[model samples]
Target: NLTTNISPLMLMVMSLERYVAVCYPLRHASIITIKNTTLSIIASWTVSLLNNLTRCLFLLQFSLEKLETLLVKDYCYDINWFPDSLRERYDKAYTCLVIISAGLAVISSYTGVVLAARSASTDKVSALKARKTLLLHLVHLGLSLSSTVYHPLLMALSTLVTRIVFVWVQDVFYVIIIILPRCLTSHIYGLNDKTIRPVLLYHLCGQLKISVKPGPC
Candidate 1:
């Protein structure tokens, strides 16, 4: 009932696009062939829609008030309608499926970019910039994985001092990794203006007229 209108179809389209770009770089357009892409896109939506529909249908049969009264409201489901063991297996299977799909896409995309870079011909400065961009994306991917894996672990050990220290360290590392680069870049470019000091000082001195009156001097 509370459909947030989130379409899992978009994820499929994105995954297929990446798959084409990586697996068929030279003939991506040809191999992913418009027709095939459309089919894959449609299939992805159909599958996701069906999955959600089934879950909703199953849930609809149960009374929410009754379900909420259970001790483990989040984990508890109607075992009579769907066995507890079966539900657990389904959860594990879907979790593994998502992890594999996302992991493969990240790996495939990185491999494709690395291979493409090797075949590229560029000047030193331009090449360095390109490599830096690629490395930044890879690092971002690693951070995402670290956050997902460590999030629950951190929550579980929140009471322990050592765990608290580790969690904070990880958070700080993530913040630095994301923020330090931009700060460094700004400083590097800001230093390039040779007249910056003089110009700033001149403005601060207020020697120039404030121009309170409309008439020119």
Candidate 2:
């Protein structure tokens, strides 16, 4: 779906934004000005629209029955959904590109953050904070990519899996993919930021600046 493709693009943009902030503090002002950021976001949405929307159009070319088989949750509905086909090939290639692009962004951003931290002559505290921030970013990216639950080998197993097993696998991983990235990661972001932390804590704890009652683990 468009959402899946855009998720990776958004991650790439955020990585670049962080990279600019840490690696090019002076240049950051001019580089990520409001107009430039707007353009970058517009570009992300445009790419997602082109890539996934084109794929959806391709599905429309097929008959109703064929399109039904080409489901978004086809892994659960049909174990053989990823069978060899032009469409499947394109889908896999698109996924590969998204992952590769995100991987490169992560590497570049993390490297910049580390280098900037080391180069900071006076602000050791800021350097430490940058490192912590990068750590959180790494964790978030992993979770966003569904690395904890979705491995390459397990993905490969999709072609070999039986129906019942594939269904269960799909169901479990779908939750991790959808809910974890969409909801919890945002909370993680808010929890780490100074301005947003108190707001989130107040809503979560039902009190401002008070010891939060232990809720669900």
Candidate 3:
């Protein structure tokens, strides 16, 4: 849950950074300093932690009534454990809030970059690259949010298949929906960022002793 919440928040920050870089190049250096960036990251994690702690309290409140039933359950799923009306509503509301906020941030940042890129004074090449990076961020955000539907998706699939088949389907969905997005983030950044690509390749293919040249690979 902490990762789930923090991921989008961090992406939002990254998008904002790109927006500032492209739209207000001179101000980017002054505004996006090391201390400011560090504070933003710290604040994002703090908010995510507080949000998770709040959800935990809600889960505890709802679970108290079904303590015995929960204790006997072989597997613990959040939806099954916190099936109360209030908790479910809270979960949905919070999920929507996060997704909407992150989506808007990415979209608006991209839009700003596009507008700035059109100006005669701006560097078209850099703006174009920033636009692509922002688009990837938007796609990555969607992939990350898809995990929210994992439980309901599995529940629907279970009714259509045998237990064995349903289990197989569940495993596949878990990997694609819940796991893949998190894993893909590093690759997305490494491949797209010129500075990081060589380092990433060097470590990934270390046995090959790949050269980390300043020139394009």
> What's the TM-score of each model vs. the native?
0.40, 0.71, 0.88
Candidate 1 Cα errors over 4 Å, as ranges = 1-26, 54-85, 121-217
Q: What digit string (tens of lDDT, one per residue) describes model 3 on residues 76-101?
A: 46666654678778778988998999
Better of 2 and 3 by lDDT: 3
Can you rank all candidates by lDDT, best first? Answer: 3, 2, 1
User: In candidate 2, which residue ranges exceed 4 Å CA deviation?
Assistant: 63-84, 120-122, 147-171, 206-217
- Whichever of 1 and 2 has more TM-score, that candidate is 2
Q: Model 1: what TM-score?
A: 0.40
Candidate 2 per-residue C-alpha lDDT over 1-217 given as tens digits, one digit per residue, 9 for 90 to 100: 5665566677777777777776666787999988988998899889988986666555445666665656565444222443346766676787778778888887778777777777735255655565666566566666666632354445676779886887787768777775567665565457666667667788888675765343221
**All candidates: CA RMSD (Å):** 12.9, 5.4, 2.5
Q: Highest TM-score among the candidates is held by which one?
A: 3
* Per-residue error (Å), model 2, residue 8: 1.9
Q: Cα lDDT of all candidates, in order?
A: 0.46, 0.66, 0.82
